[model samples]
Target: MLHGAGGSGEQVLPYFTALGDRLSMAVVAPTAQQPVQTTSNLDLAGIFGSRFRMPRWDLAGRDFPLAALRWALTELGADPNRCVLAGVSMGGLATWNLSMRFWHSFAAAVPLNGALSIWESFGTDARTRALLPNTLPLPLFVVHGGKDERISPEFDRESVRTLRDLGHQEVEYVEVPEGAHGLDTLGLAEGSPLFRQLERRLCRASRTDQSASISHRANEDTHGRAHWVGLDGITPQRTAEVHARWTAADRVDIEASGARRVALYLRGDRLSPGDMVTVTVNGVVSPVRFTPDLATVHHTFQNTVDPGLVAEQVIRLDVPQPPGDEPAEPTNRTRGRDAETI
Candidate 1:
């Protein structure tokens, strides 16, 4: 779980101690890496605050915050598939940001009184719009106060509506009519909507790899892979996307945009353990040998630190272009190495 602005992991322990005990779960919260020196809330500007001196998640980058959370999980040996991320205020925004970017890392997310709409432009929309269909399953429980003055409740309401309109079915938005910006108070209640959502979603393993179809988008290599699929050789400063579907017992259809390489991390799911599998990239068709490498399993587990997500085999395929197609323009940015198993 992440803490709000100007807040520490220790400061939010009391909020979840009783709930964690009741649920038989351990709560691990990590402090943000950067601290903003500030005297009053007024000193901060916009949603992040001005000249912020309080410790908070860095919205501009993903390395520090992600590394911190994963390090804590690694130390505790926490089950990534069963973990749920919940946060309040600025932390609430961090929850949304991290969960969306790394959907396979957590089962569900609860963001209380977060500035959902404001962060939409900053991180959510650009990073997720292309993969919304794939991301819709990562359940969300959102709460906001109708009387919130610091972060308007109407913002969350509008964002929720937009998500629903975009076909996200598992999102739940709750508004406390009489509450204010400090809706973290409600999150402490056992009967609150956020807690109930966690009760229903937490502790359940997220079977992201079992899906028949998968879609993913990424602007950077570090955030490229999702579920059992990955996009590689993406152009710098360009977002790459890939969609794959099991069309038949032994056939997989794949389409990619803004990418030159794609990989299928396979398990025993319809196509694995077989001698040969048919792969269709764009419209080109080919037969590829299916081989499960033990080394791959070890390497994947080492990277993800989750046995449930390890793939039995990986099939690397180059994105095919139509005949007579012109090559893309070259850029100064160098491409990263091949994608690792998700």
Candidate 2:
């Protein structure tokens, strides 16, 4: 797994620490070459903008991810192709860039809230947009949050949309509600354990075989679906009165494990008998069927986000609200691990 900009290796370590203890897969996260000094403790946008100076996954960023993969290969006595590249934000950009360049070098690619803006950062005129969705057979999982402010949901949407539009079947997209953009929130959240499960699914003894399939127990695709359902529409004043705030556009409190079928529930007052709604998983837009039973309504989505990006993607599902047994509201969980809430 990889870390985000101005972040360190420790970011992606804990997710696999337990797995390393059992399967003994060595977990590695290298530091960034340059660190931007925060001004007035408010420079996420500026520093991140600077990251685009080069292709996100270009040599400057790829070096560490590559090094870590090399180290894992050496320690495991396995080929480099058996590795998985994953990261968040800038690191995620590196993950995508490296994975594309060395598609055949690894077993799978996982990028959490990453983009292809490296060329913009360096003032390069290369056709990066054209180069994306290139000919690569490796699987990828891309995660994002719907409410992400710094990177915005459109960034993740466009990435997945392009790949899907290009007809690349190996990609998967996941969006979470109320997911934070900060690394600290993502690294510690219990929902973030999805990474551990994802790694196990993509693990291979050797990276030499292209046709080999890594096993993923969490293979429930939620593609081709979308929906807009909120609680009677949450109100901030009402939340504070009850020690709560509106989440998921003011409704929903459930966890998603990519079930083959996703059941959505809406508050009674949220939608009427004739209300119409739809869902967007990844970028596949699809309307949902309403089965109102009280103030609750729900739907199941198949293959919305790319699957490859989900399991192996270094998702830092935001934890803006306190981390507890309760999951973030569904619609708000768009950014995956890139949430400032986490």
Candidate 3:
């Protein structure tokens, strides 16, 4: 859970605590670290309706919120795989942005009366537009008040429309006619429609496997990896994408763009030691033998802080770029540069 602008974690934590008690779950609400800063655009005053600096989520940064979540999970000994993210107003916008960047971090998301600028933020750029669909696999329940004064309901509606246009089918959008800025009045109630939906969905929720077939996109290294696939040596300010899937128990197919290297994190459950794993990247085939490392499993757990994401084996492949592209050598790791399989 996250708090809106000018709000503290204590404000939302109590509500989440009661809701968590009812649902037999643990809850944590993290406060935004920075206040809304001044922008050079003069229209910002009229658009945001702010005369002075006020608290707001840092939509551009991913570190603070993610670190808060890790801290909460560690302190409470909570199951990171079973987490759900929920927020109201400014926090709701953060919910949408974070969910899009890190879909694997939560099972579902609830954004109530979000102050969103979805099309303006992500749709204007061709690179961001292409990257949006890859991060929307998880379910979302979006709510907005029809009579909101501070932020218009059109924002939420347009966001939902854009999401649907991007091929997201697991979204539910609700508009409360009598509600105002504080839609949480109806949304947070124990037996409300929104609450009931959350109960039903969370009761049976299960996260997608990290080793499962994946299609992911990223612009920077801060939030690059998705599922079991990772990208490195990507061109700055350009979107890098990777699509990978298991064709057979020991065969994998991959496609990459705007990246100099792609990595596949394989686990023992998916493939055995000494098995000849066939990999195909951008129409290039390489047959490499699998080798499980116990240290990799431990390091993966340490780095990700999620047991479900631990991998016993890892394979890296260098991507072939067109002429005039100056992609650097990866600082991480990889193997199987030659010997075509087909």
Candidate number with greatest TM-score: 3
Model 3, span 118-224: residue lDDT tens: 33432333433445565468888888888887657887787678889878878778888877877455466777776777777767655665655888887655556
What is the C-alpha lDDT profile of model 1 across 262-302, one tens digit per residue?
88887765555656878998888889777888999888877
TM-score of each: 0.80, 0.49, 0.83
lDDT of 3: 0.69
Q: Model 3 TM-score?
A: 0.83
List residue ranges in candidate 2 displaced over 4 A.
19-23, 35-62, 118-126, 184-200, 203-342
RMSD of 3: 7.0
The candidate with the higher lDDT, 2 or 3, is 3
* Error of model 2, residue 128, in angstroms: 1.7
- lDDT score, candidate 2, position 40: 18
lDDT of 3 at 41: 16
In candidate 3, clashing pairs total 0
Per-residue lDDT of candidate 2, residues 222-281 (tens digit): 110112211221211111100111233333232222222232323334445544444432
Candidate 1 wrongly placed segments (more than 4 Å): 35-54, 58-61, 68-77, 116-134, 191-209, 268-274, 321-342
Which candidate's lDDT is highest?
3
| lDDT, candidate 1, at 178 | 78
